[model samples]
Target: MQYRHLTAYALLSLSIGLSACSTAPLNLPAPHATETQSLLHLEDQFHLNNLATHFPDPLAITPEMKAFVKQHVPESLPEVGRLRYLTEALRNPRTFGISYHSGLTLTAAETFEQKHGNCISLTVLFIALAKEAKLNAWVNEVVENQDQELLADNRIAVYKHINAVVQLPNKQVVVDFSDLGDAYLRPQQRIPETRAAAQYYSNRGVDMLGENQLGLAYQYFKRALQLDTGTSYIWGNLGTLLNRMELYTEAEIAFREAYSLDNNDHTALGNLERLYLNSGKKSEAKQIRQVIVRRQLNNPYWHYGIAKQAFEEGKTEDALRSALRAIRLDNSEYRFYYFAAQIYRELGDRDNYHKFGIKAAMMRKAAQDAE
Candidate 1:
């Protein structure tokens, strides 16, 4: 399984978008002049040390990295040719292929040694190699179609799939390390190296958060915000950390800031809803949930989840309704059609069952062919 997939009870959930203009119970200001000061104060107040200097540089081209690049990328080749050679060399199992490793985010050098890293480490390694090879390559953020899974702690782990891009005069070459097909990946924008580095820090923060290292996670999130304050996910992660520490007011402010940056960030919206519910603001929580439902009406995965749950509970009619809605939202997902077939089978609708069953099979085959 090169690409992550959802089994039963799985929510093929996309990030829910809430209206940024929606009225909120909290009077939070947009990030402004005092933003840096507030961030610094948080660091000072927590008595945390600035450890960015000690962290490994994800894009640093080590001696071994340089040697690998020199051996693979020919100096005589044109820029495009060199890029092609380097990409091919990296993916060739005989040369240097990196296996997909979740949760472990390594630097370029570490990834080279271990031959295993998540998407972030792989992207960093590619950028490093491209730098040594003198190719114009950098990290491109995939804005839409983010892959996510539910963690054991009931937190959603959103996979921010990033890949490297080489811009040529005629065509652009994308170096994707993941097995996700074109249907699942669409590069939105090219981010600067600093933001890419911030991603490394944020990933570490998430790892620390998962391991219950509160202090360490705080520092990492702070470091990430210091590097790139525009990224909503980092702010949302900081909010999560603060919420865990019982800093409700600060967490609410952080979550609001995250929502302000990206109105479509469902995670931030969901976090805000949770905070509201925990604080016993039932009215506010209900309002936020309504907004989430309105936004998620366009998300097929949410409907699929409802369908799956209803089916498991023996409500075949309700399951069929949600399943059909899922298909209407996104017919490309074979799982939706497959689930619909199951519902139809349970209802004794043999004709529709066979119809959906055939469609599911065809969709699956088409998806495989695209890959």
Candidate 2:
């Protein structure tokens, strides 16, 4: 099962829970008991107690995708000159989000034929074409002001709008959808100081860390901290690197800084506790865990992480219990069901195995449909 599919399963389960709840009391047990039991049954049937089982390894891009990218290569390079063309394309009244949405809905060939798309679609197109042209280009996930306004409706809805940035001989230029106006377009603005920039660098650091280039990744995270000192994410990244490097003292400091910035950053707290324990400071680790327990009373991810750790260490019963707690807190996270499914499969529970399998399959299908 794919991670996306697992996510879909979680979402479907949540949807069912939300829609099924009505003001009228069912002819069941107490209201709270009925709700709790119903959710638990749904979780068991779907194997939501185990998340790791549902996530398949990431797949390689298809040959067809590569061929499509090569065939419809853009004529212009993704440099400063391309900004003018992008602005001019945006001027057409029809070339708004709707147009871009259509382009993204279709394949690369279809989008190339249209020659116009929305900010996101255009950014994708630009990145694809730039890659084909062998130009240094990447899609920057920025939180725009428009995205901030949209968040009033949903906080978890990350404003993942894409924009293009080109590295010129002299300077870099930002080709953003929002910057496209009627009059002569202005020069690309200087890189601003924001939490988003911190996130951007932290993500780069993560990528580097994945490649095992810890030193480079640490530098990127440092740069991220310089850009936005208030961001807890950078501190988290820094702590992760320090831990990997076995710089226990520095790692603890970084984790503490992250916790100071956002007490809700469980990763930092967990890392700090781990570091304290490794350093033989068992009392300090216990104290930190106590603090974490007080703050993370209602946090599902904390429970999920603990469950995952237990599962990995061959403690099936403990893993199952922890996962169940996590699922009870937030049934919408697909990983919970995925993990539960794995545990059931291990215990030879065929009925539950199939139930969670179907749930995961359905969720994966939904995600593919959305894409």
lDDT for each of the candidates? 0.72, 0.48
Per-model TM-score versus the true fold: 0.78, 0.41
What would you estimate as the lDDT of candidate 2?
Answer: 0.48
Candidate 2: clashing residue pairs, number: 11
Q: Please report the candidate that would top lDDT against the real structure.
A: 1
* TM-score, structure 1 vs. true: 0.78
How does model 1 fare in lDDT? 0.72
| Per-residue C-alpha lDDT of model 1 across residues 1-371, encoded as one tens digit per residue | 13221111111112343344444454334655465336435755455655343677778878988999899999899998898788778778899875777757788888888887888888888888888988888887766433222211124655566777887878777776666555233435888989988888888887887798877888878777788888877888888888888888787778878878877667777888888889998887777777776756667776777677678889999989988998898887778889899999999999999999999889878765754
Give the range of the ten consecutive residues with the poorest summed lDDT in model 2.
Answer: 5-14
Worst 10 residues of 1 by lDDT: 4-13
Candidate 1: C-alpha RMSD to true structure equals: 5.6
